[model samples]
Target: MSFHKYIFHYRFSGKSDKPLILFLHGFMGNIHEFDEAISLLTDEFYCLNIDLPGHGKTKILDDDCYKMPKIADALINLLNELQIERCFLIGYSMGGRLALYLTLKFPQRFHKIILESASPGLITDRERLERVKRDEQIARKLARSVEKDDFRKFLDNWYNQQIFGNIKNHPHFEQMIENRLQNNPKKLAKSLQLMGTGVQPSLWDKLKENKKPILLLVGENDSKFVEINRKMFAVNQLCKLKIIKKAAHNIHLENTFIFIENIRNFF
Candidate 1:
């Protein structure tokens, strides 16, 4: 029953009576992405930071679909291996989108959900196709000049976007992004093209319909996801939206204090 087959690595060695918290990383990221926060959270809860398929040490799934639901299936299998019935789930970016999907699809399995800059999927099919092509092109570039997967180049290209560009100026931002992007370029590229954000299902319609406690956090100026977050809060009964000042897509890294505080307040 060793989930080492599906999970790259897991972090948790403390008591079991506490609430279980599972941390999922985004595309091109792994378990180590949560090292700083996980240590702080471990005493309050048993924290499990896992590397999902196609990231970190986990082997890529054989299926070509690699969609959110399929990835969630792998996660459910991992939980089964550990005999875990339920846990609080948190996913950032790509991981966040997957978290929302899992919660909506299996509400009984999650005590609560914390989503950071994650969307269920694009609002329309056209947007999804455009995004997939754009992301796929970037992934191709990553595969070409990854430099032992140092990915400094890929990250610079990634962060150059209006929202994430200044992350380099934030004190801990560079290190956090560096650590998260240190995985193999081929894997990162494959994950992005095969199971990237565009490949996810739009959870907008489903979020309003679900009663589970869902917290959506975004940076105030992120503009892109901020609109989505606001819309959900405006119409949804069970969802809460919190925006971190002076932060963008990577609020957890840009303003860790506020990000953690909001999550603490919401949960």
Candidate 2:
């Protein structure tokens, strides 16, 4: 279905009467990213997996819709269209940031939220401005790569980041690359330009205002996000930080068993 100029593709699985669990994938990811985990989760909760703007089967109708708050509103409209009154939210990385935004915007709409390797954005104006410049440069590079049709090179460069070092040799690494390649490069570039963390409003101050239960998951090896989530937990007593021992940024893929177990226990 289309909402706010974006075509959203979602999959609903399991019984309708069960508590709903909405799954949002990370950047360069699609609904399929949650397949393995959802296969195990459907037994307990009905799952709603969606392809966010510019990813998978979803289409970006307007560039303005790529903003984080707009994307969150689009998802809320989607849930309303599906008649889902409330659901548990599980978001990974970029998706986690969006989930956090949505939960803050509409606190009553979510029962619980689980964020994996996500942040609340830059705390200071100086930090935000610096990040904006950095993200813009990266986004422009990605746009040029897309224009050159060098998607493989772009994917290679993206996954080569030190944060993903742990998952580089996983058996599913090739498959992961293949899935990312299916994304529309133009849309991806626009998404980054509009929705990058640099442009997102800092929600650090809103952390204490959240009353719903929050489970913040971070890979032990991803020091940056580990510290970020730690600060998040410190401010919100309802928030819990769980560090996956042997994983990095993409814990769901690198430590699938532990990731699934954490989700099961959290919700």
Give the number of the best model, judged by TM-score.
Answer: 2
Q: Which stretches of candidate 1 lie over 4 Å from their true place?
A: 1-7, 61-65
Count clashing residue pairs in model 2. Answer: 0
- Which pairs clash in model 2? none
Residue lDDT tens for model 2, 1-267: 878597888898888888899999988898888777777777888999999887888877677888998889889988898888889999999999999998888989999999999998889989888888887887777777763348888887888787775687888888988888888776787787788888899999998898989999999989888989999999999999999988999988888889989888888
**CA shift at 28, candidate 2, in angstroms?**
1.0
- Model 1's alpha-carbon lDDT is 0.76
Top-lDDT candidate index? 2
How badly does each model clash, as a count of residue pairs?
1, 0
Model 1 C-alpha lDDT per residue in residues 68-185, reported as the tens digit of each score: 6777877887787788998888898888888888898888889999989877678799999999999889888977865744477667667788767368787876676667565778
lDDT of 1 at 203: 79
TM-score of 2: 0.95
TM-score of 1: 0.91
lDDT of each: 0.76, 0.86
